[model samples]
Target: MSGLPTVDDVRAARERLAPYVRRTPTYAHDAIAFKLELLQVTGSFKVRGAFNAVLQLPPEQHARGVVAVSAGNHGLAVAHVGKTLGIRATVAMPESAPARTVERMRADGAEVMLLPTVAEAFALAEERRAQGQTLIHPYDDPRVMAGQGTIGFELLEDVPDLETLVISVGGGGLIAGIATVVKALRPRVRIYGVETAGADTMRQALDAGEPVTLPAITSIATTLGAPYVSPATFDAAQRLLEDVFVVSDAQAIEGMLAAQEALSVLPEPAAACGYAAVLAGLVPRPHRGTLAILLCGGNVSIDDLVRWRSTLTV
Candidate 1:
């Protein structure tokens, strides 16, 4: 499979994404170091793909507009891009989504369709396909994967000596893209995916040697709630990627706290799951080489924040 994003594709993605997205900072020090992804447009890495994907659309495609499904980041991403590019977008999201995110999407001119779950939101995206709206996959398209691959391009270009890059896996886009770039550029550099144990579709797929779908899941990392893995991406990881690890909701929350304290970035549980890997010793420790963890998303429910605050007391 063509998991490796070509150097040309990386360059093109850099050009396509340069206008709206930040070149998110790469940080290093005596201890753990990483890319400051909260600097991303819409406050997460999703913006890179959203901006590039929507902007790359032809006039006809733009006119048809775009639609996507997400409980958090992807919805905001497409909505944010639509505002910048004048493309009409609709985001179908679960009703359980944080209010702050829903309001932001609405403010950006995207029609919000609230459903009971992320699965239903995806179904709604399909429903709109009949109306000529193109699907902006949350994390499945080759273009989006290529765009996310730019993260690796930037990361490796800046920190090629990195031994292990820890990234949170949602719908497999970020890991797939980053893995492709790292593997092609420095095959020895390990790429490990950290996912919420509650929704480990990619992990399941890797174990099964094929994409697998879960029946149901309940994880605080709503943005990482991918029930099924994409065959194309799964095959890539199966062939080229390194490892997949799982983290619990409590560990994910702890990682989120570490993000707020160490990096001053309020990452969502899924975004913080990568750090949870370090906390739990999944990537091994007492090493010398650099480790780049993607800070990922900052969106969080007020309730989740309150819960995190309460935990600080006990």
Candidate 2:
């Protein structure tokens, strides 16, 4: 196949990843159905890509180990994959990453490095990659995207008449993979990507007609703070998604609180922003079929929740 993951590649990924990932269930509430990826292993859909990226490596490379850079969830996913598969893993994360997530990676037996910024973490991971360690990129790889595409397969099977899908976009892997499958199988399904206001990587990329880097990330949704989108992901979003919506951090917090009240599930700001778009009337309600929003992660800590509640008047 080409650099982009094909539908057939996604099908193979589903079979290959069957043993490592969860087929998260969808929950219907009022006008929307939520794809509860927050309940996925590692508290996010990132594990699907992590496992697929690592498991595909030739056995000989396991000895050379692997390196990855992430804000939090992807690091946790890579660490967990390393432990489960008996491969050595090292993760570089920004110092601003959640403390609980850092501890989890260490507890999972991966060497964890704390850098001053996300860009430094990426640089560190690149240095390691140049030294022969394989880089299991968070979103750029076709294998990782194929793993995420598995969610599209499940979504279609569960909601056969699904008319619309709203997904939170970070580095663009999640929406790209899902849109590939959803559009391939159900041509008319409208897919939209969402981002918190300060971390609108894909939206900026869309405007530039190519992937563009942000000056800095300022959203409370730290996990959504990718510096830029990959070309493949940008192309996929440009070709497949109906549009990309940007929601404020305050609005995302409101959506988080709403989901907690309605579904009794607490989601991180990154996960809640897509639903925030739905709540803020950015996404149109589907007339005849299901409108699904992906709750992509639930990695927020109690301390963070308390802080958000005290500061943000939601």
Candidate 3:
């Protein structure tokens, strides 16, 4: 099967998911325009992929319901899917998952199981699978990847002359999917993948030339702290991306601060990962064409954010 995604697939996803998802906004930053994917339905880009995965499931399975494991965004994504499909949902989330995020998932009507941490959440998800629950993966699924590719399509539509597209990697769903479309449609565009310094499973995976699970994840940016990068995403990224990079949680904080200072936007740590690349000098500012970054989400607690602001170097 071809690893590339087409414009038609994105168009179909956009149409089928129109009522359920948000088209979001595209912001122009002098030289570049960003898709502002953080403005998507669930306040995260994952909603696009989650809805796509749910829609792809067999009708019976959709009716049977779905389950997922996430640090936060993916769980919220699945919760959004459940709400749209009127399906029962059980999301396994780490106990350390942000309180605001946990409440948001509940608001979306997902039955959330809070494990000790992300590791335990995965174990709980496997246990749920044995109970006949359909798993709507956050990543590592073609349907999900195709769904996220829609973001790439939107970017292309907004900035036909885009020169660079930088994305933050968790399980690599966002970048892998973006690369799938952009590399095929705009082969000249540079694809840059960013990961948190300590939680850089995807970066490590690329360096080793294969997927490798980190023994543990440690980062203040909880949402982008997936302990492992799936082989499927690694393969696609290795083949399509220009480079894989890493940044510190402090850098992610800087990214968030940059959005607030420069654009007056409130961005979550996960959504801010792309700008982390710019701060770390991993990707340069394009002087001619667009240098777009995928802002993945915006669901931070005001109190926690206030605290981050006090200590952030931005």
Candidate 4:
């Protein structure tokens, strides 16, 4: 795999995953546009990467099974893909992950191990790799980033006049892939990344000129709570991304509520970061054309939604 996924890589991934993943739609609300990746198969864009990575593996490797580490969405996506491809999957998730997310992964037939933290989950996943399981990293792998890049390909096709693309960053696979494709296809179109203030991995990585691990991730947007950005993702962001912005947890909740009110969708806090940036005016708007905000995932449970709703009134 290359250090960065090329446009050809994304195109190939699109062809390979055409039948399995949805070409999720984009819609304009007010002056801003939204890419509804929350409507994807596993209720998140993570499935695109999951399917791409799993399908790329040799058929013989399938027998050894696959392992992954996730706060929630990535594990759920991997579990869903493993079931569809008939491979056994074991996911190491943080013990603090939402119960609904844990239950969803279990329902999809993955053996879910609850680790004490995200770092520990990754450590356990590495150990499982040493034990012969194929490790499908959530965001660090090129194949996975190529898969996520397919969304950028779709965006250009669906919204040819797009002037800027705003995306939420976690471990950076999603934005890395999208930025690579978008920049290649339309260099003039700016790409921006958003993260919760407490979990600003990409911002810190860019500021330091290298990937840095945070001592702790304290954001309510647990899905965007990657402790460190991977080298590939960090490199991609530096080369392609125009700017990175941080929003408070409360602003993210407000963005979630705003999306639900305007588009009738309740995005998880991580997915809401892009919208949060817009709503908070943390990033500059396009002067001449439409800005596309990626609504990356919508995996929050009804109970969680109610709790988030209460925060809005407070």
Off by over 4 Å in 2: none
lDDT of 3 by residue, 60-140 (tens): 887678889987788888988898789989999878777888888899899999988666888888888888788877777
State the lDDT of candidate 2 residue by residue for 96-125, as single tens digits: 777888899999999999999777888999
Best-first order by TM-score:
2, 4, 1, 3
| Tens digits of per-residue lDDT for model 4, 254-304 | 888899999999899999888988887777888897899999999887688
Candidate 4 TM-score, C-alpha based: 0.96
Assess the local accuracy of residue 294 in candidate 3 as a C-alpha lDDT between 0 and 100: 77
lDDT at position 222, candidate 1: 76
Model 3 stretches astray by more than 4 angstroms: 1-11, 309-314
Q: What lDDT score is found at residue 260 in candidate 1? A: 75
lDDT of 1: 0.81
lDDT of 1 by residue, 1-314 (tens): 22445656766888888777888887764477768887788888998877767777789989998998887888899999888888899999889877888999999999999999677887889989888898988777777887888888888877857888898887788888778778877888878888988788889988988888888777767788888888877877787667889988888888887777776677888888999888888876536677888878877765877876576431
Which parts of model 1 have CA positions greater than 4 angstroms off? 1-5, 286-288, 308-314
lDDT of each: 0.81, 0.91, 0.80, 0.90
Best by lDDT: 2
Q: Each prediction's TM-score against the native?
A: 0.93, 0.97, 0.92, 0.96
Name the better of 3 and 4 by lDDT.
Answer: 4
